[model samples]
Target: MTEHRIITIGREFGSGGHEIGNLLATRLDIPLYDNNLIRMVAEKLDIREETARAVDETTLNSFLAGFIFEPIEESSRLNGTEYVPPLTQQVYELQCDIIRKLAERGPCIIVGRCADFVLRDHKNCINVFICADWEDRVERIAAKYDISQRKAADKIKKMDRERRNYYESHTGQEWGSIDSHHMLLNVSRLGMDRTVDILERICR
Candidate 1:
């Protein structure tokens, strides 16, 4: 607890990354941040939760030529009526600030939204990438959401593409690539309980 440990879980959709993170947090007795973060961000910005989530982990394809990027450290991180920078950039900065704040608060698990890249400089942070076989991913997705295998596969492809693009655009690293993470885990091979146990041992 004194070390301010932070775990960032970067995962493929339907790979049980969220479930693993939640279980890990429960076992470790710490907070797990995932989609619930949208509410926090929304409240801070005084915007609708849907509005905040609209840009969460998503990139803006619209052209913004010749715009200078503001350094993250310089962000005001306002909790106000209106956003300061372009909406996408503003949301990104705000999330970055929240992630840093959460890290400083103490040991916790953060899932997705490029948390690994955001806290890349934190000495106490461990970045993990979770993956599984395509079939395993598809099967998990279909079972959890009551969708057909083909639909699940389509969802997996689209989600993976978005995550890759989001990570690369924000962090300049290949998404789900081993080089980007301290550990690359296959939940399909290890199983969820064993995966959590392995991560616990690693963190210890």
Candidate 2:
């Protein structure tokens, strides 16, 4: 619909959610934000992209916080005498700001980073959750990363856990719950092209 100015996709690992976002963005002539946010955050904080990406869509428990290096800006803000949140929290805050700005700029496809919750008050946004069969996910991940199915399954489990924790921590809501999203699609069931076609139609 014309009112759909922003689309946020929440997906399971290896579910083809990112691919759908890419296809939809291209078909609609809009911007797509995903891993590129890591680059932006890294540049903004003057940190290594790997450093930024390590915390992306992941959280640090108190026990793990001891190992994370605080952003230079955060450390120097109060002459090293103030309490700064964990690097993961700071990254999440920065991402929220970036997501808001991008949404304000124009229509775009934002994949993950809890963009659906971040833009909860934006009237022109549509949030979609994507899932796939376990075997399908395993196969997709294995092919994508050139890893064995067992390794792919392990990676999927880890990533899904991190994403779920990150989303729940920041938004205080379940990551892929039906009530949290406007639409839920099974990419493995519908196939990539058909899923993209449905989303493109929805955006129109």
**TM-score of predicted model 1?**
0.86
Report how far off residue 25 is in candidate 1 (Å): 0.5
Candidate 1, residues 3-39, lDDT tens digits: the string is 6889999999988999999999988899999998888
Per-model TM-score versus the true fold:
0.86, 0.90
Of the candidates shown, which would achieve the greatest TM-score relative to the real structure?
A: 2
Tell me the RMSD of model 1 versus the true structure.
Answer: 5.4
Clash pairs (backbone) in predicted model 2: 1-204
lDDT of 2 by residue, 1-204 (tens): 235489999999999999999989999999999999999888886778887787888875544333455544565445657556667877788989999998988899999999999999999899999999999999999999999999999999999998999899889998899989999999888999999999888879
Which segments of model 1 are wrong by more than 4 Å? Answer: 60-84
In candidate 2, stretches whose alpha carbon ends up further than 4 angstroms from where it belongs are 1-4, 60-81
